[model samples]
Target: NLGDALAAETGFKIEMIPLPMKRMGPELISGNISFICYTLEAWLPSVKEQVLWSDVIFNNQNLLVSLGAKPITSLKDLDKKRVGVVVNFYYPNLEDSFNKYQIFRENGPNNESNLQKLLHGRVDYVVLSSLEYQYQKKLQPRLNAYDLGIDTFGVKCAVSKKSPLSVSKINQAIAAMKKSGKLDRIFRLP
Candidate 1:
């Protein structure tokens, strides 16, 4: 939907590709993809060195969720607890505490799997993106969640260093969308 909005606003044709997170960087560097969207700069240090990043398109909220019956209100509560985390993803401010407190991390292939672990009582809590958590709750209303508000970070699109598209152009369209409230409307943001 953002791509569609950007194209409409800028009069530029956009091609959207949905690829596994790990493959996005390789494909971008190889010139197989023009740009990859919805990525965090923190998660792509190497990719940042290789590509041009547009201004933030949106913010991704990183949350620590647990069943409402046993809400995890603070990071200190996770001491020696099992945390379900997505494979290859980084926690913004919790890694050091994990080691110092003996917090056990259970790797899940994706958000859904981590969510499942929490639902089944396999893990004390799971870290998930707020967007993913909302979508899952829509599918299964039984899951109760409490927000940890661990961190919030900007999400940007990465373009090939040699691509014809200018980061400024993309940023312009994104700015227009934000100004017109098109992004908030499309994403149902507050």
Candidate 2:
């Protein structure tokens, strides 16, 4: 979707190279990748020397979700329970908050394996995006889901410093797309 949007806006033949999110920072720094779509917190520190944030594409709220015979309503309820999370800047904050609730358990990086751990009772709950939860539920109907209200954060496209000109054009195109409601339309497309 992003490749199509970038191509249509910039008139450039954009080719997307899919890589695991964990490897994106190093790739960007080494000039192996031009840009990356990721959370602001994760991209900020890694790109301090050679990259700058271009524009925000979406805002996502992370949820602490649980599945099983019991329902979770508050952070305190997660005490001594295993929680799954993606490795990112937000993990520290999550860890601090969980510590306050006396919730200490295994923490694993986000991946299919970690998700499987949660699904199979290896972890007590998983912290992830609400969209991810909904999508996963469709794949596994027996699992219960709960939303633990949390901070909302922005998702953005980061550009390497070597491509300042490209960033300018991309930002301009993004602004136009927003003004024309093209971005909203594209995102809502089924």
Candidate 3:
């Protein structure tokens, strides 16, 4: 849908290329990838000089999720618990907790892998973006999402400096959409 909207506004075909989380930074720095959205600029600090970050697309928060019956309502509830997570992805707010070994991190390849781990009882809890949790909730209604009151950050589009499409052009289209309410409509889409 974003590709369709971008193509309509920019006259260029928007091709999405999927890369492993581990390879994303390297690929972007090497100009082998154009862009990725729903990403945090903080995650790409190593390649900050080689990438262009767009305006904030939306705000998102990190939530602790579990099966409805096993609701984890607060941070204290996570003490010494193993939380499923994406391998190599940083959880900024949890760094201190992780460093102190107060909570354990159980790595998986991606969100789906982590969710599967949770559902299959491989882990007691998992972290998910607010938007992602909402989408997953639609498919599995027996899930509970708990906010830790941390890790709230802006989500934005990250464009490689070597991308064929300039950030300015992309920004113009997004700005237009934001001003005309198209962006809001997209977020509200079922």
RMSD of each: 2.3, 3.2, 2.0
The residue-level lDDT of candidate 2 at 77 comes to: 76
Can you write out model 3's per-residue Cα lDDT over 145-180, one digit (the tens) per residue? 898775988877788888898888888888887788
lDDT of 3 at 148: 79
Q: What is the C-alpha lDDT of each candidate?
A: 0.78, 0.67, 0.81
**Candidate 2 residue pairs that clash:** none
Q: For residues 95-149, write the lDDT of model 1, one tens digit per residue.
A: 7776576688888888888887888899987887777777777877866665666
Residue 127 lDDT in candidate 1 = 81
Q: Order candidates by TM-score, high to low.
A: 3, 1, 2
- Best lDDT among the predictions, by candidate number: 3
TM-score for each model: 0.85, 0.78, 0.90
